[model samples]
Target: MTHIYNDPRGFKEDMIEGFVRAHRDRVRRVPNASAVMSSRAPVKGKVALIIGGGSGHYPAFCGLVGEGLADAAVIGDIFTSPSAEQVYRCTKAVEGGAGVVYSFGNYSGDVMHFGLAEMRCESEGIDVRTVLVTDDVASAPPEQREDRRGIAGDLYVFKVAGASAHRGDPLDEVERLARKANDHTRTVGVAFGGCTLPGKSEPLFRVDPGRMEFGLGIHGEPGVSTSELLPAPELARLLVGKLLEEAPPDADGTVALMLNGLGSTKYEELFVLYRYVSELVERAGLRIHHPLVGEYVTSLDMAGCSLTFLWLDEELRELHDAPARTPAMIWEVKR
Candidate 1:
């Protein structure tokens, strides 16, 4: 059973209470809302990079709010999209003279609500743009890639946009690079078990004993395939193969790799997986840049992992290498 909380219905609000309190120096509540914004917001001449999505994925929607990442996050309840009103508040709070760039995973509810917020911003004379991260290659076929869902690759897109914005790039430039980041990125994941929502006693789904599921969703959805649990090396081969297969032919041989643990997967297990993944990327004739191995995006205690590859050009590599200081990730610019 999922553990630790007060009232089941009050879970989201209580979590927010604890979050902002602990990170008071870094973030603050959006006032009468479940949203959060970087303490250092509203940089007068720069574009604002606002991100949002469901709760549960900590250090993501909220943890990403700081310099060189997200300027604000319109948060929502577990696995649910934030409301249109919430989106507007965060947008208005962060908009500088340049404009606002709204970035988030490609989800139906998020698309609907963020759209509503966009129209409202335009009517209010605030410039706005959007870049939806659709880097989950397993969600759709190559010919229909736009229909794919966004998963762990959301971080790459958001990070690039935030860095661009931080550098005082205009809204259009930030939006373009973020879309480009999404185009250059791919992710494939496997799950050993499903996650349980807060207040629920049973997991949303389950893998049979001695097996694992592949191409799974972050919100505990079933994957595309299930087979006997393989060793870390074989699992790494399967995931890396799918990503490289779908990568664009023009993709440069350099990649920013993210080996993410989906909640319950231990770090020691991830380190083992990363050892194999690092070798596989090298074997595929790709150079690794800013390779990360840990939980950046995650499901709620779901025991599994995913590998994300962001094939990079000179521009992408520079943006990624720039300094980024967030609650969960702190990357210093190379001297």
Candidate 2:
């Protein structure tokens, strides 16, 4: 299904080169490293926010590098973790003398690799901290929240960290706010089809014609369960209801929500789904702030979608509304 590539081994490299060429005004390739940094990075006294993960999820680990977002994003092979050396090189290139905060999904490989980089950076007197995103509710039960996988919810966690750091917050404060954002976020997804890796002939997995895989992962892993596909309204209820059940203890009815498409889903279809989602939220007496309906985090070409909710308090709301300009997302105040 993956049709465009000269060689499988060089896919990531080629993609990076093209990305840097296209976004040169806002970002630049990290010298001798598989990473990209904001053009205005190393902001003298600002805490640097570094976010990354495997390739294939566009607008995520790379497209997010810009003003009011991540200072840098390290890239890796498809569905693979970036090397520790790559992370260290990116840190050295972007740290502005304040500190560094590394944030990414909570996967075994990511945790191990990023941890190694963190230790190395700290040894050289760089105050580097990390915040793992664990927001996929279907990956773990409430009693084992720490074991959940990170999915589309990466957006909220990264946004909070970037905004906090952009405002010149100390490393401690940035880390705290990032963690708080992760704690308040939850996501659940389903897959109607699977994605094929570059240079591969077959998809990673397949879904039945009339059924959907619930709680699917972003890395082509199958879902936890499967059921017959329902109409858009029913699907919306299924998603919104699941999130409301796991609302944080202190949730006060206000939330930031995102309905993210995996890939191959039509934009018009997403709007139809949101019509029902918005109604469901109001019916549950929750106020939706800044509802986003589009692909944010994706599993390359997978036909599916996920819904995320960030239970917001005063602080989270302010940061969520902060001005940001990136390749995939842009928010600015109206004059």
Candidate 3:
């Protein structure tokens, strides 16, 4: 059960309040809106990269705002999409005249709301584009990849989009790179338990003892299927197998990888899993490029983890290695 809150309805607001306070050096709250912008936003002549979704996924919408990442992030209530007005306000605050690119998970609400804001911005003569992240392999078949939900793959799409924008790439190129990143990425997750909302006494869903839910959603949704819990190494094989089955057609054997914990999973446990995960990827004739193992996107207190693969080309590799300093992630230039 979730604990420590004044009012359940105000959870998102309270969280944002504390977040901006803690990261004041890197981000600032957008006035009169549920959004945050980088301290150096509105960089003239540079495309503005904006990403957003529900508030529960930290370090995603807000934590990603800083140098070399998203210029702004519009946040919404827990597990809900931000309103179009809030998105529009955020766009006005950081457009910078170069154009704006909005990237977010392919959830229906986010697509509709962000699309509205995109239209409004373009109507006012501000160039704006939208790139949806659809990388969850379990949500759709390979023939219908565009219909898959976006899970941990948000990181790859956002990273490429932000790097492209930060390097002063033209708006068209930024949008293209973002789309390419999404196209090359795929993910699958497993849930060991469910998360409870603030002030709730019961979890959104429950997994039976000794069993696990595979392909869990980040918004308290149940997994696509369930099975007996396997040992860490076996679990690692299951995840890697699912991804490799749908590896992108142009996969060049080099991939950017992430083993993301979904809230309650311990970092130590993820490391144990990654040990076998790394080995299996190499055994499959793939080179892991700067693989990450930690929580990048998460459901509040959910016991689960997802693995993501971003098949990289030369350009994507360079962008993935670019320097970025954000509240949640810090990547430095390779010497």
Candidate 4:
């Protein structure tokens, strides 16, 4: 039972229309497409960063548009990839003459469509490079890690990519840093309930009362494990333990920790969980840097959350703490 809009097919268009209006001060729609670029996009002489993904994740591909973030974002239907034509149109708006780097979660449809856009750019002489994010540790085994799905860890990929471009790094360097961000990040999540897309009377999946699904997808896809919902502290220990087992960082190293709500979880609940999450990180002998707790990425109305750790080396730490001015995020350089 979704209570959001008029028509299902027209839902995405309407949402985008309203989004640009509300954020007009910061973003503008690309002519003839659903892409939205920063009001100050095309920062000539600097590399442009264009990010895209399916709709439904607010403050993601759209809200992330602004200075020091993505230059433009291509919009697709709810959980659906945008067409090559739509992505192609984005190049015209965000191309800053240096080049454009298209980065996004490593989903099948996104790969196909964005790949098409990559070829399109080559034909038109617009230098566009693609960097796919694969950071969801639960989606694949370490040996096949490259095949994993990209989840909330995408924020680090976009942030580092955007920061690199903002600093006028060459396209090659930007792509390298974007991939490095992906390599340095890992995420694992759980879902307590499922989400219902617009015009649907039922959720995509279901969980019994007092039970939960582990490693669930953002689109309501089931996870690798399921069990009764545990208390906040226990849940925190479980999540941190799983992530560390997957890829343990240096005991004395620092990491950027993010506790993200999957759309329906409350900030209060997340804070309670963060208390224990913080303790575990310190006990693990790792210092948490710029630990963020909020709804940065989400599933439609799924009552769940995910934990992400971007293992920070010197360069990653510097770029991550750098200033970023976007519709949904802004930070002054701490220098």
Write one digit per residue (lDDT tens) for candidate 3, span 222-254: 999999999999999999999999887788899
Q: CA lDDT, every prediction?
A: 0.88, 0.93, 0.92, 0.88
Misplaced by over 4 Å in model 4 are: 248-252, 333-335
C-alpha TM-score for every candidate: 0.98, 0.98, 0.98, 0.97
Model 4 clash tally, residue pairs: 0
Q: What is the model-wide C-alpha lDDT for candidate 3?
A: 0.92
Better of 1 and 4 by TM-score: 1
lDDT of candidate model 4 versus the reference: 0.88
Candidate 2 ranges with C-alpha deviation above 4 Å = 333-335
Candidate 2, residue 19: lDDT = 91
How does model 4 score by TM-score?
A: 0.97
Error of 2 at 274 (Å): 0.5
Ranking by lDDT: 2, 3, 4, 1
Q: Over the stretch 119-182, how does candidate 2's per-residue lDDT look in tens digits?
A: 9999999999999999998999989988999999999999999999998899999999999999
Q: What TM-score would you give candidate 3 relative to the actual structure?
A: 0.98
Query: Backbone collision count in every prediction?
Result: 0, 0, 0, 0
